[model samples]
Target chain A: MTDGQETIKSSIWFEEAEADNPYAAASCYCSGYDVYGDLLGKVSWVQYLYLLFKLDLPDPQHARLLETLAVALANPGIRDHSVRAAMNAGVAGSTKASALMAAVAVGAGNLGGGREVYLCLDLWHHLGSDMEKWQHAISQPSQDERIDVWLPMEHFPGFDPNGVTCPRPVVQTLALLADIGSYQPLIWLRDHRSELEAATGYPLSMAGVAAAAFHALGFSSEQAEMLYLLLRLPGAAAHALEQEQHGWRQYPFFGTALKPMADADYQSLMKTTEAK
Target chain B: MMESTRNSLAYFDNHWPTNKGAWFPGEAVRYREMSLFDDFRDKSWMDLLIYGIRGTMPQPEVSRLMEQIWIICTSYPDPRLWNNRVAALAGTTRSTGALALGVATAVSEASIYGRRPDIIGCEFLISTCDQVAAGGELDVIVMEYLKKHRSIPGFGRPIISRDERIEPLLAVARELELDRGDHLALVKRIEDVLDRKRMRMKANISSYCAALLADLGFSPREFYNTVLLSFTGGIMPCYLDAVEKPEGVFFPLSCSKIQYQGAGIRRLENVKK
Candidate 1:
């Protein structure tokens, strides 16, 4: 109000050291329920996560959906780079939490975790209710237009380079669900399946569904990546525990690859061992 | 992106030919015409475990089991199943977490035969029929499993009255000349008793896998670990299915379809209006 500059005020947070000893309230909350006193323990972890991120709980079906997807994401094997990183750390004698952190850290990268999912979600947000825009953008474009306009890159974010094709089972499942539930984003994606496949040389990926799912589940773009880490946590921990039990030794990469030298060099190398 | 690619290419080019060893063309990695049994026989069981689970090379049986798991998983991806529903809701291509949960939950239950939670140890299979190991009665193990867990690990499935996998997997085992294991006989006995009880619960793929793992000389814990890893092969395709699509494009459903029973639309009346 003074000199055209307005004073700012906020009420989302407060520091309370009152005589009555009242606890401070948060705009968001926890402890077996959300800020609105919804019972948290009654819901699945996926439901709880949705509540935390969006400050609202999804329906039971959606919650179940989230839970299902979360379960699918959990893999304790070595195929995942994130799990391998955790295993490496565990073998090196790091604590369980520390090893899990290592896994989560690797998951933050493009290859191991949810970065691709987030990127896909971001693109969707940018398009917003404009299916034509996405269609035009993703379709084959002229070389000049590609260089000039903000057209899509040669590689659409989530599509794989190993040649793209949607798995038959996923497509069939999605088609079945599409009959029961109607959503514009999914309809658009489903309708354009063949076109997208032909253009990109890859089928629609699970990340596409994930991006749509995240958006539908009311998660922000950033939460997509975080969710990846969160879901992978237990699997990583399992790997870490397993690695701790498996045989381990400290050695540089390819320590055994180097060729042994002739008599003089070998003798010199063994002198320390001989002395010991 | 271009810069990163260029940098990577430059680094690779710089590091090219660090060694002066002669190049040798090896056998083609793909076993297009080779027999699964023959390929499996080339490697030891330890190598199979290391390669199939923790390492890259996949064993034939492991691949077959994983495929079976994947088929069963993909069959009912409706909202009724927690794993499938979650994947559909999340818009994930692979149902990654759901698959993990499925495998983990499945493997975790391998120790149960009747309600007693018996470990599927080697002795259980190789020992005398009279010996009641791990508190599991040989003749009454099925009943015990029913009494304890109200369900068996390798028997009974949701959404289906019968598990179709039992017959085919059993047939495969027979053809492979692996059907003679004592564990297989015990599974049959359990199935027969369940049949008599009118439960009609046939031994599932997990039960057969348990028999196979036991026959292969894996410990109970190792059996659990291998089972956990074996089924993972199927989930990858599902994940790939989802990841390949454009962002925000899979199984799209609206918020209205989600049933809300919690706190209704209410204004914060106490806040200064």
Candidate 2:
């Protein structure tokens, strides 16, 4: 190449002819796909999801566990933050898509939502690999007591010692499935329930259990929350639809009555503060 | 519910520790044993609201008026029944100030400006205060703003016929012997003119804050920032309340309870093509 042409090329751009790609289309070569063309027609959606997330197809047992876990967490009910947000949006005459987005926004802020789940998953991975950190976490007081400071990844209260409404069918089913699949995390949670409870004042939370399962399954921390959002979307949509059909502008909870500020009280309160 | 001393302490305790972790990182590190509003010992709410406005604090009367105004703002909508109750619930519709603000703040700087009507109202009032301070007539300035916008900022509120805070704020301002500042005088004059004109507008809490900020020589931006900082502590109790609920489910509803209005199910293939 001419010096002038080479200079222009170098200054403008450098072509990446041998750049590696993590995804591919219309080709046999792809992550864990000997034949992408065949897998497209043959693989189940759940199997494909597993491959996409794990970068490898799951065995039958692992596939069932992952599928069941997703199903169990899918639509927790109208009480769920995301579901109620969606329904409220729908009641306010928002479009279906807007309602769903509203629901996602609310859900994304909860303790089990994307941010907290990501934290819990991160802690799970950290605690799994590091014994010292695990020891510290177990020794810490219940999350409620130490409101002064908090780490995002803390509070996997699988069983809140103070009473947790663990959806009975789902939790029991997951535990049973975990046994059949021989997943160590689920088994560990089941076997060491009392010990873990003793270590941390709160029992293992639903999200904590899910985090442990995700960690054991080799899913990354970031993937854990995205996976949750995706699973919960349909549930939120269902609530939005229901709200559109039967709900009103307001929820059941009556609003707080505003106290008219009595002049006497205002004076007294001011005087009290001044006196203090 | 009557806010007992214990409940008040709980409200303060819930917010102070979590403030550093959740939102405002600028708060000084606080341990468990420290009292609520501990950082502002002997400092009244007015002092905190206008912290950076002037090197010297306002006259003692201004301080007292500001204190009364703060009390009026904080006293209403009981914290236990509202902030720590219904309004702060996670699924609370956008009707609640906290939920709406929560969503608005989530958007980056590109979208934060328009969500806060109180801030907008304060900004407009601050600008008007500038002109009045520059010797502009309150009637002419207000008329010009009303001609363009059909409503005056810092006056009138939705969901209520009268603002409860105005009279108490004025009473407190008068009691404190600081009722005659230029901004305050102009605001009262505007209220009188509006009343005579049959325009049902009354000064609200923002009006009081804006007057105090302007009298203290705060720039419009400083007024906005300072007022928001003052009230940001209020939203924390709602958040703490919501999180304490089971699964953090606030103000829950059963699916069958919802009323649907959309079109019934229609098959895609059944439609004429």
Candidate 3:
């Protein structure tokens, strides 16, 4: 506040004014780190990313864990909902921005998506490493204080309802990251996988794993969500471009999935409507 | 697997099944049990949309009122709206019409405003009506909702206290003779409580339309489905107007507009580089 009146300002970044023009920035700063002068070649993207969000540079271990999580999360595969959404846009000649937008829209869901990861992080934050608390919360999902935004956790967030068994990738990724950091929640989650699976009656998804890792790395649920969304876009972008090249005819169709209504069914339906 | 098997309408058994109808090119398209070419070719666009969601034709007046509701909301083409701004930006970037409209429409499903609150408002009216029918006191029902939610959806608005669209919308409903719904009556009574309790913060369009829709026997899911593209008509004009302008002209911000309150630049001498 200049004179006790607070002027709105961005806390994330600022640019030093050039000598000649006030409107231009000569040097850029992000969370207090000099972008070009201090960090450009010296720091890895992972460390830089950590500093940008957390406003402090990460230790090597933290950077390594985050970089591992980032690589594992980079591509969610062709069958993934977010990737398919981008692919659909690409095949139909949607703009490049549209392709990414499609991915983000589809990815922002409570089921095996960024929202699930965020919720899982919140769970970690609230009930850290307590098996009893985790079980109770998963069993009842303590009611949301406000009823306006998210749908109630239908089937515990982060665990895949449709999963038949714990996927090999989830197991492998958990093993890789769980050992790196002393984030009690991740280690606890890794050790108590069976108990959690038993409680929720489903397998741990990549979202659950990533949420645990991100939480351990000191990212908030919101930060984890934003990072999760952006980090997963590379795969979506590649798949969309591929699908666009392949064309709509080459794209897989679910047309056979649609069962045509019988004439008898049609007549019955119309008759029922008239009766109503 | 064991638990999901019990709830498996959508499952993986090397088959993806759909009860929602499909099209056979050159023959016809099937919408549930109705033939699009044979039964629905003569139907209005709104009729098709409503039928697609509800699986039955509404009465003529119900159809008229629903269309009128869409038309009433369509008068807003102002790009400054939260959802419409996305559309305007998309236009300024010269994005495709599909993406511009699609993204903006997606943005309209916001938490505090748009479809989320509208659905909540509708559900509140329906559930309250049900409770009152089941011997619950009206005052207790409303008071409990306020206590639980801390805020009521349809009873108040941001930026302005009263809703301007309510009167015009109610007038159309009256003209169509579709105004006298039980839900509508209860909603007004609930509004009386809110006006007295919440310092004259009157009910807005969401609760009003929600009450009306609930009165007309719309389930919350069905109401959501039908009004999915409710903002498209307004969003389209803003997008179209923006696309006709020079690139990035919709709302351009220069560097000076930013208030940089972040840390000052530091020297790199401490670094090991």
Candidate 4:
């Protein structure tokens, strides 16, 4: 028993010291999980996976990895089978990750969650350009001429170039993270800003704040992705809890039910109310 | 019939217009009487009886019978006091202006409520902003107002604008052909006014949309209500975003003069000694 304990302790100590253990990296990633959890909850797991790969894990344990994957899948209410397929495909590196991410994006519908993620990326893309110059370009006398130049400053008025959430805590976090020498997340933010912005109308600064906080706390891409799932899970949990507590079973066909009204019913209600 | 009466009572409770002494005594009396009937029909007789009997009734004899039979059902949480407070708080000239806009626009635009005109307008404005921001030369006047601390009307810090969804409604107006030309004219006129004033006060999307709804023959009241509904979509998301990403923690008391003055007094005493 003593020998077994000693061996286990040595293995644990060795893994901690190795700096390349994926599980250790993941644990490190989890520490800063709260940063973008809220925003990420609104995004697709596939995008989260993309970010995870960017975090550069060493050798992640199978169980820990699966737990992270399960959290992401279950949080969004994605079917278990689909999640398993995606996980398998993701491991195989068959661009199935992108397909899964796209599925999550489609599921988001027009609720503006996925779009917000894209907006964050867009804002991050133009962090270093002069704000005044961008403003000037957008406000130039020749409106037609100004349209040709896709300057970030001109495009996003009253937004900070470097500050996440524009003059908020995200900038501070980014500085702190940069000071600690974790440059990969910030670099990704800078590179993906445009595409994300075009996809989501929200500013990059908003998303960057969360990304910066996670990066500062040493979260790998996978952990960051998981953090987003965790953040969004609370909202869904709250809704579900509320539904359960209230015994609020939705009956769509019943006009008096607490469910959302159909267009015709809504119109009739409005008409009746107006007449009154 | 009873349900209609109840609904009418609820509606009155939610949206009873305040008395500004604009009507004659007879008119006021008639309005109050009408309200009583509406309330009586809406609430159950038992509910009314219980409320009337509460001992705090202003006049004992009058209150006794009133308390036993009359119940006032208010849409507000607390009818007697809260409704008055809300009314008092809402008694601003700006609210009157909003009322006036609603009335005038309603007379002009009759079809504002068809198929969620406000939502349609919002979608258009969003699409336009995207197109213009991408490469099209769509005139964005609010971008200028953001410069001067005075907001660009519909684009920033919403509460002051109240009817921020007007621009999108105007986009809807373009489709309905109710008052599209007039709506566009209003937008152009606002631009002209801003240019003349040199203050950069461009007409925001809200005003434009409101004008369009007016053109579509929606009553100003309906137009305002639709605008509120449309803007609620933006407001809800923004609130969620704000909650998820709080800007900063503000310490109101810490920054108060009491703390500073208290410290200064100690410093002064030390200097005297």
Report the number of the highest-DockQ candidate.
3
Comparing 2 and 3 on lDDT, the stronger one: 3
Q: Local distance difference test, per candidate?
A: 0.52, 0.55, 0.80, 0.34
Error of 2 at B256 (Å): 50
Which digits, one per residue and each the tens of the lDDT, describe model 1 over residues A8-72? 22222112123443232332233223344434335556665775665555666566557756665
- Candidate 3 structure quality by residue, lDDT tens digits, A43-157: 8888778878887778778888999999998899998999999999899887888899889978988887888888888888898888999999988877764344456677787
Estimate, for each residue in B189-208, the C-alpha lDDT of model 3 and write its tens digit: 88788766764657788887
Off by over 4 Å in 3: A1-8, A16-27, A36-38, A141-152, A261-276, B1-11, B267-273
Q: Highest lDDT among the candidates is held by which one? A: 3
- Docking quality level of the chain pair in candidate 3: acceptable
Between the candidate structures 2 and 4, which one is better when assessed by DockQ?
2
Best by TM-score: 3
The residue-by-residue lDDT of candidate 2 on B153-226, one tens digit each, is 56876557576767777777667666667776667778887887788888777767677656666654555554
> So what's the TM-score on candidate 3?
0.89
Ordering by TM-score: 3, 2, 1, 4
The alpha-carbon interface RMSD of model 3 comes to: 5.7
